[model samples]
Target: MLLHTFLAPLALASVAGPAQQDHYGWIHLFDGKTLEGWTEKGGPYDGDADWSVENGVILGREAEGARGGLLYTEQLFGDFEFECDVKINAPFDSGIFVRMLPQKRGAQFTLDDRPGGELFGIYSNGYLFHQSGGDAAWRSGEWCHTRVRCVGHPMHLMGWIDGKLVVDYQVPEGMDEAFTPEGRIGIQVHGGMNDPEDAAVRFKNLRARRLPPMAGENFTVDESGMMTLTAVGEASGWQPLFNGVNLDGWVPNGGSGPMTAEAFEAAGYRARNGVIEALHSGTAGEIRTARTNYRNFQLRMDFQLTKLANSGVYLRSVDDGTNPSFNGTEVQILDDFNWEAASGSKLAPYQFTGGLYGAVAPSKSALRPIGEWNTYLITCVGSRMNCALNGTLLWDVDTATLEPKGGPPFAERAKAGFIGMQRHGSAAESESEVGASFRNLFIRELPEMGPSAR
Candidate 1:
């Protein structure tokens, strides 16, 4: 089957050919003749579901004297599109599960075909959303094409059965804390229901493609070697902090107070042609969001630095003219390759890129080459902070456990404040015009649970 058909509705034509398989990012979960990439015993309740491959399909039946369980992918997926074809005998129950693990209650897309059963409904601890008329789309005893697109931080899920949309739901803000960001995908054979011993559920064409967190938008590089955004739908709550035109929502920290965007520009920062460029000037100061009190949030941005450039991302920074690196927290961003040679000083463990500035060091350096764009995903939830550089996790630490260099413990710092970006003057002695550039700055605030909740 042409898997591209599943993504046609999204207008992702750029990912349509075999030569662009990396861009397509689709992996066939099942080879149609074996269970090489699947396992049945990883989940908490590994049921005795008789699973085998026959006639280019995965066949599942209840083991003798046993009920049923799940068969899950050996690997895990975060945001992705999952597609399959299911054929279930009537009066049997089965489902497709996402973000599933032994310790986590991942959401499920119901394939229940029993009398009075609900198909395509989402279930976790309870019915997240129950399908009202899903049976109308069910093709019993036949291959029913199924697709589920799961994306975003809180997880927006959409399911289609035989090309008919049946489930469209997003995890509510209040319930977002319950669902994890990633886990294994599973196929379930529900237990405890009485049925014929020969009843079975068959699946084939099982495939999935990883998706970016931005959902309907594609970030692409143009022929001129600049990044651009292609929007296809809503960004699912991810809001652009830099509009690619100007710094309207940002203010320059002028040591005494927050200054206007004009001051930010005068301080050598300008947003032009979808990129925020910081000029290499000694007078350049930090720029922060005009909006403050960001308690729990996920911040994503792409940045590229010149040789010996130094910078940091300040989180929950106070507005009292104090250094944000002490008042809140700073994730160090530096030219990891050339900083030591340029500055004549060895970098401490906590001074490396992606480290919690002066507090916790990253496990390893994950920075891209200088002059190449690197992505940062910084998530701050209560007292815990995680930083992933260029898709590799650098650290996931509880800030309350440690103290910043020459500063108070993180537990005593401001719990909620502004998000800022620092433009530390170049480390090179020649005073070169080497500074950092940023783009695609986006943020999504999560539901705030206080420190006690952690």
Candidate 2:
């Protein structure tokens, strides 16, 4: 069974005044006067529901003898914060759906504002959570401010009615495989014989803001605009690889394998105060994971570099003393702004930060400043490799189809091997120091499935 909590309302103000205006980074789903950016479609019923904009509010009613349907946003959202004011007539049934597609079952925040209805309850296949005493939280035939926040692959959902916390639910582990990570937001007018012709639900001041992947209760944005996870949520399936104090599961490349924190430090890396610092000692080497056979996984980490630094993260690399950049794959990491000036040579398109080194370049540059921390979210499954840097997707491509400029095709590279981080030797005297610092290293192994499976 899933767990949920109904907490006392916070002393937050009602959704009025400044709340009606658009904020930075927020997308207004409704234009207040027109039905633009939205589409009416049958959600679970056979015919469309009557939908229109009336006096800056979206009104939903049953169409003639037809059943009710959904009004969905044109754009899709994966993780987001959504807000709107809702007014429902008595005995009407409606809901706000997230990750919803037309005619498909989805997670819903119930607004069944009638006797025996479960207001603010979560309904998917059935009531995932049933909120009792719903009438205490509902204001019949009047506008009630509602907000929903959802995040993660198997989403954690929360809802508030009139500034009071009504539901906080995490999708159960067993249901992880069934959840859709992204879909359109929908407003449903449920079909039922009891729904009178005058019964309707109205929504106004609709807006939403997209959130980063895996962002939830444990995620935060620092003052410098860097996203950090204080701890991985249990439902997120992410395991911390770096314990913030040791290298117990890591090894120096070309050595006898995994070592203790002290032993690993002696091999040119320092682990202290939650950061793993690679000490560049004029000779290029790497630190690799002791477990050498990760075939499909999602790897996330935060890295900071000294000025003009050059480094790379190796995926599925062989242990035959061959260059991992050629044997497997490397996601290039460099001081993008200063690398060319310091090296006195131009960089290939595939040699910049977030690129699949030697094969495919990033779609755009998303690196933070050299001294500030930047994040990498790398997903590898079958022939596809996708990378996101600092919350921006850089590339999502199939390695099998890529032809490298000089080396063998990426399709021939090892499919299972060690995960490593490269230290690209020393920098010139005229250049700034060259080293990389890393933290929050986490990985979650994904089920072995091809791109079509996704």
Best candidate, TM-score-wise? 2
Q: Write the per-residue lDDT of candidate 2 for residues 17-117, one digit (tens) a residue.
A: 22122313356677788877787753443247788888889999887774688888776777777889999987898989998765455699998877688
User: How many clashes show up per model?
Assistant: 0, 0
How close to the true structure is residue 325 of candidate 2, measured as C-alpha lDDT? 82
How high is the CA lDDT of each candidate model?
0.75, 0.74
What are the per-residue Cα lDDT tens digits for candidate 1 across 132-170? 978999988888999998886588899999999999998
**Whole-model lDDT, model 2:** 0.74
TM-scores, all models, native as reference:
0.51, 0.53
Q: Point out where model 2 deviates above 4 Å.
A: 1-23, 42-46, 102-104, 221-358, 361-386, 389-454
What is the TM-score of candidate 1?
0.51
Using lDDT as the measure, which candidate wins? 1
